[model samples]
Target chain A: MLNCKQTTKLLSEKQDRPLSFRERVALRLHLIMCSGCTNYDRQMGFIRKACRRIGGDDAK
Target chain B: MNSERDGNTSKAAELWLQEAEIATLRRDMLRFAKLQLRDVATAEDAVQEALSAAYATRGRFAGRAQVKTWIFSILRNKIIDQIRSQTRHPTRSLTQDDGRNAEVGALFDDGGYWHKAARPADWGDPEAALGSEQFWVIFEICLNAMAENTARIFTMREFLGLETAEICTELGISENNCWVILHRARSRLRLCLEENWIKRG
Candidate 1:
């Protein structure tokens, strides 16, 4: 099982590239059991959205 | 009648150009350039060059993209040229430095879990942050606070949406090191936003 630190690292990495099937499965299982990691994932998504807005690249 | 209509059409085009608000466009271009170049003087030069290029080519703009988008693309090319020139000089490595190691250590415990105090808190209504100019002000400060190379990598990925391969090729770093730099940048930005903007009420 991926710990919080490892899971969060993977979560951040997903923003830059697609994850493999095995990596996705591991992350999914960890997120299911871990609320903290789940929240971390959501915040990461928020950051991506906020950055798109601030950078004005959302139109592109 | 045909000659008169042509004159009217030309007049409207002149009015449209007059309405483009060059000053605001320059400010926005400077903000983006500074973020990517991380140097005020270079960013100013890039924006100046881009604006002039835009003016010189205004007739070919064709109105396909937003005015801002068109200018931004020009500025993007300028930034790429700057990056290429810097790479040729090879002044420094883009890989992890000692300070980055300390930053990475602070986020993880010996057991490889998020350090208790370092874990992220729920940031309610992320849209609120997006809607406020004040939020972006703090966000820019946080971005500038990061290591220059790390900030460059992060902006290339997040702001420019460049692929990892492209970023590695441009910066002359390996794929693995690029990912590490991005991870560190994200972790630090997340914490900075949470403390400085999200948690402030």
Candidate 2:
């Protein structure tokens, strides 16, 4: 069982795209169960997007 | 006849080359290996060994992953061997009066005061700066500062876009272990960039 930190870290590493089916389900379940984790996930997404933009690898 | 056998061998080789289309991928692999080894000779040797092994055992590749992934797996193994062999003997001590140490040390102040480092005059939008050379420099410094194994895993996965399963297989690491290494690498990199680049803006 991965903690929120681990889960969000993996999410951040993934290239900009929608999560896989399993990931979507897992993330949804985690968000429903843990508000703190959900916020962390959102923050991670924001940072990743910002990094990609700065790195000039922004998604089409 | 011998002529027929020669023709068949040529045809087979040509077909394999067509199927593999390995030249561009080979260049990328070589560049990656060079970065990891930090020496041209060893990096080239690693690439050659990997290509030879891949050629001899090409049939083991099941085509599940992309061709680049498969070749990268072979190259990763070669690099691991190189790293292990290099580490087997006592190398240059880090405490030497080398300029390399001084340079890296200066990047961080006493108490690891990376937070006090200089910043970009205008970091510009984080989105727009991603493509700038500064990000890559910060990225390189952060990556070079990580532990060897951790840096290898991150480079293989993040820079090369390899799958976790492939990284584990090639690096002889468990899935969970790979994740942990990658986790640490990313967090450290994030912290480094925030302190050095992000905050500079």
Candidate 3:
């Protein structure tokens, strides 16, 4: 089980690069059991959504 | 491309902005400039200079819809000019000396768990928050509150849309350290936004 700290760092890194299959599996497994990290992930998504609006890159 | 430009020229020739529209656009450009230059007077000067340049070339612009983006790119160059002129030494390290380590450290505990007070709250209807001017005001405040170098790197990544590698090369920092800075910035920004904007709502 990845702890909150490791899981959060991975969440940020995944934005910059593709994660290995093992890393992705580990993250998915950890996320399934952790509400806190799950919320953190969702909040990160919200931030990116906000970024898209500011940059006007939301054509999709 | 030349033929395309010719077609655009014919279609776009009649799409010039009115004086009133330029006046309104100045406010948005000023807000963007103020964020980068961090000085209202200097920001105004940059925007003024860019607008003057824009007016000189306004006849050659593509179309009404793209004028906003076109003007922003011009303003971006002017802001960069201001940044270069004002800073005697612009580069800084991400791993040390920015003083964010202690702040980010405080968010986590000895065992790598979120500090009780640092746990995130649910930001309900954040899309609605986006429509609020106050939300952007809070965001600007949050961004300006970050360390200078951290904010610059973040702006480079988010506002300017520079890739991490390009940023690393330009800043002369390691890829690993660049990621660290970005992570630190994001963590602090999210926490600040959550506390001041979302939680209050």
Question: What tens-digit string does per-residue lDDT give for candidate 1 at B123-147?
Answer: 7677766667788788888898888
Q: What's each prediction's clash count?
A: 0, 8, 0
Error of 3 at B24 (Å): 3.7
Q: State the fraction of real interface contacts model 3 keeps.
A: 0.47
Give the TM-score ranking, best first: 1, 3, 2
* Model 1, span A1-45: residue lDDT tens: 898888988998998889999999999999898777887899888
lDDT of 2: 0.57
Better candidate by DockQ, 1 or 2: 1
Q: Note the chain A TM-score of all models in turn.
A: 0.91, 0.54, 0.88
DockQ-based class of model 1: medium
Clashes of 3: 0
Which regions of candidate 2 fall more than 4 Å away from where they truly are?
A: A1-60, B1-34, B40-125
In candidate 3, what are the lDDT values of residues B143-187, reduced to their tens digit? 899888877777777766677897776677877777888888888
Ranking by lDDT: 1, 3, 2
Each candidate's fnat, listed in order, reads 0.56, 0.03, 0.47
Restricted to chain B, the TM-score per model reads 0.84, 0.47, 0.82
Pairs of residues clashing in candidate 1: none
**Best model number under DockQ:** 1
Which scores greater on lDDT, model 1 or model 3? 1
